[model samples]
Target chain A: AQSVTQPDIHITVSEGASLELRCNYSYGATPYLFWYVQSPGQGLQLLLKYFSGDTLVQGIKGFEAEFKRSQSSFNLRKPSVHWSDAAEYFCALTYLCYNNNDMRFGAGTRLTVKP
Target chain B: EAGVAQSPRYKIIEKRQSVAFWCNPISGHATLYWYQQILGQGPKLLIQFQNNGVVDDSQLPKDRFSAERLKGVDSTLKIQPAKLEDSAVYLCASSFGTDTQYFGPGTRLTVL
Candidate 1:
């Protein structure tokens, strides 16, 4: 079974500060990775997804993630975070195979922005 | 385009009571998914349906939980004799194909 782990349970940052959230996955074959953000009382929104192509992919709100195959990591990064960026983030992993595409998500990392 | 819709937005029940959550997927969507999300955890797939037929439900607690997508448009997830551990948000999502899932504002279930 493929699983994802997000080491940070909660992170605090000030407005306009740089942010980085670590994610690691365990999968046998090539992996399809994704990052999602969930605000209070809102549905999960897709932040970014990496299926195939370049290792670095950019997402909304100036968020970006790099798919590092050697380390089995797809850490999310933001140059500067806005107050609105304070939300729970999740990392998910799925097999790249066309036959079985069941995806598994990490526990989640909550981000809090302090003024 | 209208996103996936779910209701009631909030549900509260005591342990051992019965509760149900309803979901309406996007028009023309062929796949619907039901997920259970415990507090501070990611949503876990409870069931998946491809047009009115079950695709995957291996993670569902079949002994006490049941879900159905009749007519291939709307879905309902029911829990009989709800348990305290079942207190969590029930999320409903759908996709145009099998690639990306668009989620709805989940129904928060609180079991007393």
Candidate 2:
């Protein structure tokens, strides 16, 4: 079965510090990976996605993710964290199954920006 | 384009009661999805519909949970005899046939 794993349950970083959230996936073939952010009391918003081609993908809100096939990981990174950047992050993947697309999500990691 | 829309942002009901949630996907979106998000956890897929037809519902608890997408536009998810575990944020999302899904401001259900 295809599954996503987010190793970090919670991460705290100082404002303006760099951030990296780890994600790993178990799948047979290449999968469509995505990063999504959810703010408190709000719906999830798409940050980035990796379909094919380039391994590094840029997304909204100054977020970026690099998909490494060898490591079976898609890690999200941000150069400088701001107070508003604190939120829950989820890594997801979609693959074909039973003649239809099946999407799976990781547990999610909560980020806290400390000043 | 307008994002997905959900109604009754929050609801409080007692256990054994019934509750329903409404969702209107973005215009021209053919795929609609219903997810359940528990506190401190990621969202779980409950059901997926493609143009008024069920695409995937394996994860949905059919015994007490039901959903429908009428005319391939609007949808409703209902739970009968709600349990305390059912208290979570119900999110509705839509996409264009395997494309990126846009989510609505989920409906938070509180079962007392």
Candidate 3:
């Protein structure tokens, strides 16, 4: 079974500060990784995805994630944080089983921005 | 393009009551999904459909939950004899193939 782990329960950062959200996954085969953001009262939005190729993948809203196979990790990063960026972030793994695709999501990390 | 659409943004019912939620996927989307998201946790896949055919439903609790996408366009999820633990957001999503899925606003189900 494929599982995703986001160690951070909540994180607080001041505006303009750098931010990083940790994510780790456990899967037998090479995994398809993704980062999603959910604001209050809204559905989950795709931040980015990592299928193959580049280890570091850029996403919308100045977000990026690096897939590290050695560490079994895909950490989301941003150079500067904005107030609007405060939201719940989730890491998910897409598993392909016998031509069927299933997505498993992590517990998610709640981000809060301080001004 | 328009994203996935779901109806009844919020619903409240007492335990053991029955409720149903609806979803309309994007135009030409061949895949649709239903997920249950408990508060403070990530969404869990309840069922998946590919062009009006059942693909995966291993995690769905068949005893009280059922879903169908008849025309491969719109779908409905029904839950009977709901439990307190069933209080959560039911998310509907759709995709063109196996790529990124676009999600709906979600139907918040509350059991009293």
Candidate 4:
């Protein structure tokens, strides 16, 4: 079985400040990683993804994540956060199921950015 | 692109009652997903469909929950007898392939 762990349950940062959310996964082989954000009463939107190659992937809303093979981590970071950045963040890992299925998500982290 | 679409944005039902949710994936998307999101928890993959076929459904509670994706386009999820623990948001998502999954607004199910 595969699982993802988002260490930070909740995080707070002031507006315009930098922010980082930690994520780690337990997979047997190479894993495809992704980050998603959900605003209040809204659907989940993609932030970024890492399939392979250089490892550093940039996404919408000025978000970026770097996949580390050694660390089993794919942390999301934003140089500056806006008040609207307050939302729930999730990390995921993609792998095939018994009959070649795909993707699974983490527990999630609630982000609160103050003004 | 219209993105994924789900009906009945909110639903309220008593325990032992039955309810059904619908979803229509993007026009050409081949992969569709159903997720269960409990309060204070992340969305869990309940089922996945590749076109009109089932790809994965191990996590889905087969005892009271059933789903189907007919014609490889639209889908429906049915709960035979709702339980209090079944109260949660049912999210529908789709992907062009297996690359990225896009989610819909979700159906908030409240079972009392």
| Cα RMSDs, all models | 1.3, 1.0, 0.7, 1.2
Give Cα distance to truth, residue B37, candidate 1, Å.
0.5
TM-score, one value per model = 0.96, 0.98, 0.98, 0.97
- Model 2 Cα lDDT, one tens digit per residue, B22-104: 99999999999999999988889999999999999999999999999988999999999899999999999999887888899
| Of 2 and 3, the candidate ranking higher by TM-score | 3
DockQ, prediction 4: 0.67
CAPRI tier of model 3: high
Error of 4 at B79 (Å): 0.7
lDDT of 3 by residue, A1-105 (tens): 689999999999999999999999999887999999999999999999999999999999999999999999999999999999999999999977764778999
The candidates, ranked best first by DockQ, are 3, 2, 4, 1
lDDT of 1 by residue, A5-92 (tens): 9999999999999999999999887788999999998788999999889999999889999999999999999999899999999999
DockQ of prediction 3: 0.82
- The Cα error of candidate 2 at residue B21, in Å, is 0.2
* Clashing residue pairs, backbone N/CA/C < 3 A, model 3: none
Please identify model 4 stretches exceeding 4 Å from their true place. Answer: A97-99
lDDT of 2 by residue, A87-111 (tens): 9999999986653556788999999
Model 4: pairs clashing at backbone N, Cα or C within 3 Å: A97-A101
Model 4, CA-based lDDT: 0.91
Error of 3 at A97 (Å): 1.9
- Which wins on TM-score, candidate 1 or candidate 3? 3
DockQ, per-model, please?
0.63, 0.69, 0.82, 0.67
Comparing 1 with 3 on DockQ, the higher-scoring candidate is 3
Off by over 4 Å in 1: A96-100
